[model samples]
Target: MLAILREITIPCFFTSYLIVLVLELLRLLGRIPGRGLAVIVMMTVGLFTHVCYVLLRATSIEGVEASMLATWLDWSLLLALALAISFFVFYLMRPDTIVSFFFLPAVLALIAFAVSVRDLPPFTRTEAVEVWRNVHAVSMAGGSAAVLVGFLAGVMYLVQSWRLKRHRAGSALRLPTLETLGRMNRRCLVISTVAVGLGLLSGVVMNLNRWGYVSWTDRGVMLSLLLLVWLLGASAVEFFYAPASRGRKAVYLTLASLGFLVLALVGVLTTPHGQAEKGAAAEPGATIESTTATTVIEETTP
Candidate 1:
C-alpha cells in the first residue's frame, strides 16, 4: 500500500481527468452508452489518486518541509485538488450539467502551472508564525477557489440568459436556470470575500510577527489589498442593493472579482510573495536592512 501510494504522481490524476474531459466532450458529439457511469468512475479514480498524492507530499520525510503548503508548487496543487473536488461535487449534484466543461480546464491549468514552478523554494516560517501562515495559505486558496466558481457561475448565467433571449431553449447544451446560477454567484461572492478577508488578516499577523512591519508597496500586498477592497464593495452591493444581487449586475461583480484575483495571482508569481526569501524569519533590524539593501540593489541594477 505504501509503495502504491508513493507511486501516485501528478500524471496519475492528470490522466484520469484528461480522460474524463475527453468523455465529456464526447458526450457533446453524441450519446454513448454508460457515459455517465464512465465519467463518475474516472472522476473517482482521479480524486482518490489526487488525495493520495497530496497526502504523500504533505507527509514526506525526505524534504526540508513536510507540509505541502510550504511552496508555490504544493500550494498550486492543493488549490487544484480543492477545485477538482468541487467539480466532483457539482457533477454529482447536476449530472446533466456542462459545468465540468468549464471546471476541468481550470484544474488542468493549475496542475500545469504547478509543474512549471516545481523548482521554487519552500517558504521559511518560524514556529511562532507557522500557524498563522497556514491560516493565510488555506484561506487564500479557499477564497480563490470560491472566486473561480463564482466567475464560472456568472459566465454560465450570462450564456443561459443569452440562450433564453434568443429562444434557443431547444439547444443541446443544458445549464441551470438564471436564478440558480445567480444564487450560486451570490453565495460564492460572500464566501470568497469572507475567506480572502480572513486570509489577508492572517497574513498581516504573520508579517508583523515575522518581520515586525508589513511592506505595503510589495506587489503581492498591493494586489491583495486591491482584491480585498473590490470584494468588500461587491459584497456590500450584494447585501444592500436589491437589484444588483439577482441579475446581470451580480454576475458582473463576480467577473470583476475574478479579474482582481488573476492580478493578485500574477503578482504572487512574478514576485516572491511567500517564498523563502520573502518569508524567511529575521530580526527586526536585519529585516529592515535587508529590505533596504534589496531596494538599493534593484534601483542600481539598471
Candidate 2:
C-alpha cells in the first residue's frame, strides 16, 4: 500500500476505461454484438485490477484525517469498488448490458476528485479515539455505498423511460428492458435503504449511549432528512396509486434524491475551517463513531 505508484492500478484503470468507452462507442455506432464470454472476461479482469487499488487505499487505517479531501477520496474509492463488484458479480445472473456508459463518467469524476485532494497531514490520536474513528469510517463508507446504488438505480430508470417515451424500436443503444431496469432499481433502492438504516442506527446508538453531549448539526443532516422524506414519499405514492409504470416516477425521485446528495457533498467540501476536529468549533457528528455509513462533512454553523 505504501507504493501508491503501482503499475497494476494505472494500467488497469486504462484498460477498464477503454473497454467501457469502446463498448459504448460500438453501441452508439450501431455495431454492438451480443454478449460474448471473452468480452466479459476482459471486463472482469480490468474491473478486478481497479478494485484492488480501491481496496488497498481503503484498508489504510494507520492515519486518517477527517478533512473534506480525505473523506471524499475514501468514500469515492469505496463506491467505485462497490459498483465494480456489483456489476461483475451480478452480470452472471443478469444479461449483458451497456449500463456502464452512464456510470463510468461518475466513477471518473470521483477518482479525479480523489486525485485533486492531496497533501493531508496525518494525525495521531489516542487508541480509543482511533478505534472510534475506524468505526465511523466504516459506517460512513457503507452509507455512501448505499447512496451510490441509489444513484445508479435512478439513472437506470431514466434511461428506460427515455427509450419507452421515444417509442424506438430495438437497436444497439436500446438499454435493458424496462422490466429488468425496474427490478434492478427496486433492488438498489431497497438494499441502499437497509444499509442507510443500519449505519444511521448504529451511529445513533453509539453516540447517544456513550457520548450524548457531542451531538452536532449541519446541512448534511438536513439533506439526509430531505432524502429520507423523498424516498418515503415516493414509496407511498407508488404503493397507493400503483402507477401505470414505475419508470417515470422512479426517475424523478432518483434525480431529486441525487440532487440532495450533491448539495450535501458541496456543503461538506466548502467548509472554511479545518476538518472535523474536536475542540475546533465543529460538531463531532460529521463522522459516525460505530457504524457503516458515509461521513457527512464536518462543520458547524459557527
Candidate 3:
C-alpha cells in the first residue's frame, strides 16, 4: 500500500509542478494563452494525490485514524491541503489569470514536501490532556491555513500591480481586476485574523490545563503571539490607511506575515515534548471545554 501511494502521488505531483513551471515561464515572456485550465487540472490531480497519501498514512496507524503523522507534520499537511483547496475555489471563480502560475508552485512544493517526509515518524496524542491537545492542534491548523490564504492574496496583488506598473497592456494574461484582487486580499486578512485569534485562545486554555499556568514564555507561545501581532498590524493598516494604502502596498505588508507563520509552525513542531519518541508524556488532569473536541482528541490518540 505504501509503495503504491508513493509511486503514484510523487510522480503526479512532480509532473504537474513541471507543467505549471513551464506555464509560468511562457506567461513571463508575454506568450500567455490566458487560460488557467492546465494549472487547474494539475492542482486537482495534485489534490487527489495529496488526499490518497494522507489517507494511507492514517490507515496504517494501529488505531488512531485521525492522526497518522507527527503533530507538527500532521498539522503542516492539513494546512497545506486546506490552502490548496482555497486556491482551487478562488481560481475557479476567476480563471484565465497569470495568478495561477505564481501560486501553484507553492502548492506543489508543499505537497512534495509532505510526500518526502511521510515516513519520519507517526504522531500519536498522548493520554494526558487529549481533548485540549486536539483543540490546540486543530485550531492551530486552521489558523495556519488562514495565513496561507492571506499569503496567496498578497502574491496575487503583486502580480496585478506588476502588470499595471510595467504598462504591459498588450499581454495575453487575463488576471483579475484590481478591485477583485483588493477585495480578496482584504477578505483573506480578516479571515486569517479571526482564525489565528481562535488558535491563540485555544492555546492558552490547553497550556493552562496542562501545566497549571499559561505557557506565556514558551518560545512557541511567544512566536504565536508575534504572528498574531503581525496579522493584527495588517488589519490595522488596512482599516485605517484605506485612503493612503493601495493593493500593492497592502500586499507587501501581508507578505511580511509569512515569516511569523513559518516561525510559529516550526516552533510547535520542534517543542520538547516529554516522550520524544511519541511527543513526550501527555500532561495529566487537563480540562475539556467542548464535547466534540474530546471525541476528536480521543480518536486521534491511540
Candidate 4:
C-alpha cells in the first residue's frame, strides 16, 4: 500500500477530478441515483491521494532547506491542493449541488501544468531567509486561491443572471442565486485584494533581504504589482465609490482582475529568473553563483 501511494502521480488526482466533473455534468441533465454519493467519494479519495503526493514530494527535498514547494510546479500543485481541499469541503457542505462544475476544470488544468513543469529548475533555499520566502510564497498561494474563488463566483453570477433573464425556471438548476453570487463575488474581491496586497508586500521584503535590494524591474514583480493595484482600485470602486452598481460591475471587475493575476503568474513562470536556481543551499552539485539568480542546475543521475 505504501509503495502504491509512493508511485501515485499527478494524473491520478487529475483523472479523479475529471471523473467528478463528468459526474457533475451528468447530474445537471437529470438526477442520477447515488450521483452525489459517488462524487463525494471520488473527491474524498482524490483529495487524500493528492495529499499523499504532496507529502511524497516533501520527502524528496532531502537536502534543500526550502519548504515542500521549491519550484513553479511545486507552487502550482500547492495551489491546486488548496482548491481541491476547498472544493471537498464545499461538496460536503452542499451535497447534490454540482459546484465542482465551476472548479474542477481549473484544478485539473493546474495539475496538468504542474506535471508539465515538474522538471524545471527549482528555486534554491536561502538558509538566511527561508522562512520569509516560504511565507511570501504561501501568502501568494493563498491570494491566488482567493482570486480563483472570486472568478468562479463572478462566473456563477453571470450564468445565474442569464438564466433568470431567460425565465428558465427549473428544479434542475442548482446554481446559487444572482444576489448570493454577487455578494460572494464582492466579498471574495475584498479578500483577494487584501491577501494579494499583503503577499506582494512580503515578497518585496523577502527580495530585499535576499538581494540587498528588490528587483523592481523583474517581470514577475512588475506584473504582480500591476495586479495588486488593479484589484485595489476595483475593490475601492465596488465598496466605496459605487456601492449601488456592485452587482454586474463587481462581477466584471473580479473577472478582469483575475485575468491580470493570471497574466502576472504566466510572466513569472516564463521569465529567465524563474528558471534558475539561486540562493544559498542552492541544489548541491549544480553550477551556482553568489550574486544573481542565474544558477542553472544540470540534471543529476538518480
Give a tens-digit lDDT track for model 2, residues 246-293: 765665665665676576556545652114545522334333432224
For all predictions, the C-alpha RMSD in Å is 13.2, 14.7, 14.7, 13.4
- Model 3 clash count equals 4
Winner of 2 and 3 under lDDT: 3
**Compared with the true structure, what per-residue lDDT tens digits does model 4 show for residues 1-302?**
88889989887888889999998889757878998888888898898889899778755654423434457786788789878877887777677566788789889989989989988877655542465566778878888888899899999888888888888735586788878899999888877876787688657645543544577888988898899999989987887676677899999999998899889899789885356665446533222343224433333323
Error of 3 at 301 (Å): 33
TM-score of each: 0.51, 0.43, 0.48, 0.51
Ranking by TM-score: 1, 4, 3, 2
Compose the digit string of candidate 3's lDDT tens values, residues 1-302. 66867666456655665675576567666655553566767777778886776566544544322233344455456556666666676667566455556566776666667667766664333322465567667766777776677688778777777888898734897687777877777777777776787678656644443454576777777888899888988877876686566676667777887788898777766775312444233433222324456888999998
Which residue pairs does candidate 4 place in steric collision? none
Best by lDDT: 1
In the predicted model 1, the residue pairs found to clash are none
lDDT of 2 at 245: 66
Better of 1 and 4 by TM-score: 1
Candidate 3 lDDT score relative to the true structure: 0.65
Number of backbone-clashing residue pairs for each candidate, in the order shown = 0, 7, 4, 0
lDDT of 1 by residue, 1-302 (tens): 89978988899999999999999999778889999999999999999998888777755634222233467787788789878988987798689898888999999999999999999776654543687788999999999999999999999999998999999956788899988998899999989987998799778767765655678899998999999999999988876688734578889999999999999999878876755564333456456657878999999997
Q: What residue runs in model 2 are displaced by over 4 Å at the alpha carbon? A: 1-136, 167-169, 214-216, 270-302
Comparing 1 and 4 on lDDT, the stronger one: 1
lDDT of every model, 2 decimals: 0.83, 0.54, 0.65, 0.77
